[model samples]
Target: MNYLVKINAVKTTNELEDAWSNEDYKALLARFEYPDAAQLKPAELKEYLFLAISDFEPHEAAAILLDYKCSDQLVDGQIDNLSHEMLRTKTFENYSEIDLHHDLFNINQLLYSAYNGKFPLGTVNLVEMEIKGDDNVEELTKETALKALSYGLSENNLINRLLSDQIEGHKAFPEAEGIVWELQHKGDDVYTLTISEKWLTKTEITNPEYECTVVPFEEHQEAN
Candidate 1:
């Protein structure tokens, strides 16, 4: 089945930088709604920016960040400061397997907390799916397919590997047990993903599994 994965969140520094490019210092200060934004030095400005956007949804914060324009030096410095601050507040170091799992769950929660629970934007159907197995091919509901794709993509290893790869065509990911993923480059900053999973059998339990396609959020929106 074909699924459309809408990436509603900005995950990289470069992407954020590319989204907005106005470097007017005064404008940057005004955008964040700082009362004394003009009086703040670079360090103070960075701190205020963090504080100002602390309560914002990730997408909203991201949109504001895209609108930001400042000198390259200042942008780099502020982004570095903000990134450190964000990680410090938003993530914690995991000391054990349980802690790691907890942290992963938190990350998932944070992703969902964006834009009224439609965020980190997992997979959704562009068309109906057909679950295919050795001797059976059955129509899968859109809802079930979405859940499966979302769960599959939620695996950290799978997502990390998928985003990191810049090459086109079939790729190998030995660490992502029970999951099979393929990439087809569509254009600049856009690609199609085909992912399949059979990890349920790891517990010696058999279940139906299916393949789905994913594309950029913008493309998916345009198609609709």
Candidate 2:
């Protein structure tokens, strides 16, 4: 089920817009601050402004911010609202990290980057553990992985097609699917996709002429 967040107040619309245009996150926090309350410092204000303008639940985000100790700049009391004021305040930026081995900490980095456009600092040590209790969930079997490889692109998820290709190519032979695409925040784009071939089956495909009768592939049907 989808959750809803309600923000009831916008004390001064003009001030909010001005802050957004200038990317003045500190000023934005001060604007949203409760009257006669202590102001947040610049570092703390950056995170609070990000949380306030985000689409995520304010409380949930606030919890993360507090965990990160970035919540100190926000105002006290119940926060009930969704606003784009924060996004409008900053330009989109790209950040990436490459780790030789995967770790749970990597997931945390993804979480931070996805939500806040910031990367974590320092090295994250890892310890291996045996995880259990996941039997209820169906695993992505070979069949499902193979099928996904043949799937085509759609407006909804242009990135999915790239994944599909990589999985198919991998099943056929071993090769890295890294360097999936060159991302751009503007202009026409080109996407490079690779899928493992370990997943493909040699099946005859019947292509019909415009006047002939036939059913198109599932991918084509879905796209239409």
Regions more than 4 Å wrong, model 1: 1-26, 55-57, 67-224
Judging by lDDT against the true structure, name the best candidate.
1
Model 1 residue 51 CA deviation in Å? 1.5
Q: TM-scores across all candidates? A: 0.23, 0.18
| Residue lDDT tens for model 2, 131-197 | 1112325332222322332232232332334444433333321222212111111211111121211
| Model 2: lowest-lDDT 10 consecutive positions | 8-17
Report RMSD (Å) for each prediction in the order shown.
16.9, 19.7
TM-score, predicted candidate 1 vs. hidden true structure: 0.23
| lDDT agreement of model 1 with the native | 0.34
lDDT per model vs. reference: 0.34, 0.27
